[model samples]
Structure formats: C-alpha cells, structure tokens
Target: MKYLVREKMFSIGDDFWIEDEHGNKAFYVDGKVLRLRETLVVQDPHGRELAVIHKKVISVRDAMTVERDGEVLVTVRKKLFTPFHDSYRAELASGDELEIRGDIIAKEYDIEYGDERLARISRKWFRLRDTYAIHVDRDDADPAMLIAIAVCVDRLVEHEHEKHEHEREQHER
Candidate 1:
C-alpha cells in the first residue's frame, strides 16, 4: 500500500518486516515505514546553511518492532557487528553522523508464484534480524567513534576466544 507524506510519492518495495503493537512480527515484501528520513535544517561548522538529516532504517536479518510514535526498532545482531550485545541501548546520540548518499534509499520487490507483486507500496518496512540507521550531526559527536569502539570490543572478545581455543588444542596434543 502507498502512503503520501508531504509531496514525495514513495512506493514501498519488496523486503519489509513489521511488528505490531502486540509485539507480533510480520514480514512484508516492502514493510510500511520500517524506515524514514527526518530532515534537519542547520548550518555547517563554517556557518553555511546545510540540510542535515538522519535516515532511520531497519536492519535486514533481525526482527524489528514499531512503536506508537511510528519509530522502528531493531536488535543488534552478532554477525553484523561483533560483540553486538556489548551495550543494551540502541538509540543514536544527538551528535552522531550517519554516512549516506542522497540516493541511498531502501527498496525491495517480491516474486510470488512467478507473479511479481509489490510487497510494500512506497512505505518503509523493517527486516527481521537487520540493523537500523539513525542519522545525527557531524559536530562534536562522530559515528565513527562508536563504530571503532564496537570494533575494538569485538576484537577483544575474539582474542579471548582464540586464547581459549589455543589452550584447548595444547591440552589435546
């Protein structure tokens, strides 16, 4: 189904995950507003007018839930990022900056019984077991910092695992 917000005519595509108010998960060819773009009017560091935006999109492989405020929430999957559960909070900070292109929009299409149907008609949908995006600012806060921290934590976890594995091997030998 297609829904028009403002003047933009959006068509929901094929792969979408939906979670209702009751906490039940549903998959849609293109889920309804599983993702959205919120535009921010701001001035750059140099005081130039710029359109800062945060496109909150859901992950592909994880289940997601939708709140009454129309916000989509997804869990941190282990495969997407190591030590995925290092922190329980998933909300992006105010100064976080997201990397995305002007044309980077989510899309999906489905084929059923050799007949293609629009699973999502221009609305966003969440993906079961997928990551989500939250755009912030590029000021004092940096998204890369969080990513780096997460990476470091993952490495540490891996290092511990490897050490244990090595000890096990030695014992066996």
Candidate 2:
C-alpha cells in the first residue's frame, strides 16, 4: 500500500494529511506546539487517535517514542557517527527490532527488518516541497504504525537541519 504524506505550510505548527494512493485522506497528523518536547498525534480519518509521538529526553542520542493508549509501542533512536548514510534503530513493543537507514536528506529510505524491507519512503516521487511518499508491504506491516514512524523520522531530521543552519549562521557572525 502506498500513501502520500504532505505537510501543511504556514501553519502555527506542523500539520499533515496522509492520503492513500488514490488521493483520499486516510489519516491526520496534529503536531502540538508550545510544548517542552516535540510531540505529535496521529489520528485516523474519523478523528480517532492512533498513535502519539514524543521526543525522548535525557538520552545521549536523539530519540523519540511512539505510544498507543498510553503504552509504549516503539522507541526510535538515531545512531551517532554514521560516516555514510543516516541510520536509526527502532525497538518495537513486540521485542522485534528494526533498522532504518538511507539518504535522509533526500528523504529516500527504507525500513528493514533484518534482510526484509518492510517500507520505502521517498520524496522523489513528488515534485512539491514538504511532501513525500511511503510505500509499505501491507502484508508485513501495519500502515498506521509505519506512517507514524516515517512522520517522526521526518520531523527529527528537519529539526536537526534547522539547528545546524542556525549554528552556521551564528558561527558566521
């Protein structure tokens, strides 16, 4: 199954509409601003909350957690010192671990379970900015969960990029 994730620009905070391959709205992402830590809630089309994502504090590495019904479902942490591609580790609630690595800057990446690829995320498929595509193996993955992960990864990467840009500006001054 394929879905298009598009972020709405010029809003008070991050907001996204996840659309199916047919362009029908499938899910809604409501980003909570004015919070201590970054937080986002993903809701189904009918407005039922599906997952909650929040930044993990007190970690040496950048990390975030996905929760459902107040229970931790997955914890995603970035691997420091990746010389080549950006890499991340995701610990699932089922005790199964997954690896995420690829061209994060270009938004082309894959979520893999050992030797099997469960999802592919890419921005090359769309020409518009702040938009990307997520193709998942429906038989092997839950679309909602995968979508939540992708959203969290995107936000984290974007936040890091903004921070670096600010630091660069400060250095120039």
Candidate 3:
C-alpha cells in the first residue's frame, strides 16, 4: 500500500526527547514531525509479538541520534522508507557523524565537503570542519537522503568553527 509522506522535516534540535509506550522517557527529536509506517508490528519488551495494525502511517514520530567524538549532536526524526531495490547512496555530516543512507552501504569512502575531506565512510564517520553544502543533483538522491543532507548543511558553520580551532591549536604548538 502506498502512502503520502508529509514535508515537515525532522532533525536534531536543542530540545528533543522520546517516550516509549511504557512511559519510559528517552531523548526524542523536537521541532520535527515523525513519519509513521502503514503497518506497525508492536512487540512487547519480552520479545513477544503483540499487535499488528493495518494503518496508513507515513512517518514515525521517533528520534534518532548519531554520535560523534563521544558527543550526541543532532537528533534525527525516524522516517521508515520503503526499501527500493535500486537507489544510490548519499553521505551527510552532522557535527561529527557522517550518516550514509542508500540501498547498499558504501564503507571506506571519502566525503569531499567544501574543498575539505569531511569523513571516512562507514555506519558513522567523524564530522569534519569547513564543509559547505553543494547542490546535489535531484536525480542522484532520494527525498529522505536529501533531507539528511540539508541538515548537514545547517551544521556547516559549526564545523567551520571547529576546523578553525584545530588549525589555531596546531599553529600554537
């Protein structure tokens, strides 16, 4: 079944928290809408299959985090994408984590960000400074991937500051 995906992009914000169904509170992304899936297979904490609802869920109202330098930076809204058998990969930088999303993961790749090598490819990568958001070809990326990349662009200034600080430290030594 096909569903209509909303346009309220979700990303890491200052205040974010996620509460589980059991009233347990966790860090969730704020200022973003969650994309829900059409079918939800809710399982109990004990791993027992609980309920399956045939619903039209376009996004998941959940929070996702990528760690960098032992710091939790951005909180991403979880939107479950239907796995397309054919799709290219796109890499994004969020503070210190380089999130790559696609059908096939490209590990050990270099991200050329604003004339600087940002991060090494993997499930995660170190976010580099001095990165700029280049115009990515729409044909080359999916909507969700584009959203992730746009978030990275938002953090480019922060990365630049970090890069400058590191350079200054080197000169001091």
Best by TM-score: 2
Model 2 misplaced regions, further than 4 Å: 8-12
lDDT of 3 by residue, 127-154 (tens): 4322222233333433223333333322
Q: Write the per-residue lDDT of candidate 2 for residues 45-91, one digit (tens) a residue.
A: 99999999988877776788999999999998777778877888789
As a TM-score, model 1 comes out at: 0.23
The TM-score values for the models, in the order shown, are: 0.23, 0.89, 0.22
lDDT of 2: 0.83
Top candidate when judged by lDDT against the true structure: 2
- In candidate 2, the residue pairs with backbone N, CA or C atoms under 3 Å apart (3 or more residues apart, or in different chains) clash, namely none
Worst 10 residues of 3 by lDDT: 1-10
Q: All candidates: CA RMSD in angstroms?
A: 19.0, 2.0, 18.0
Full ranking by TM-score: 2, 1, 3
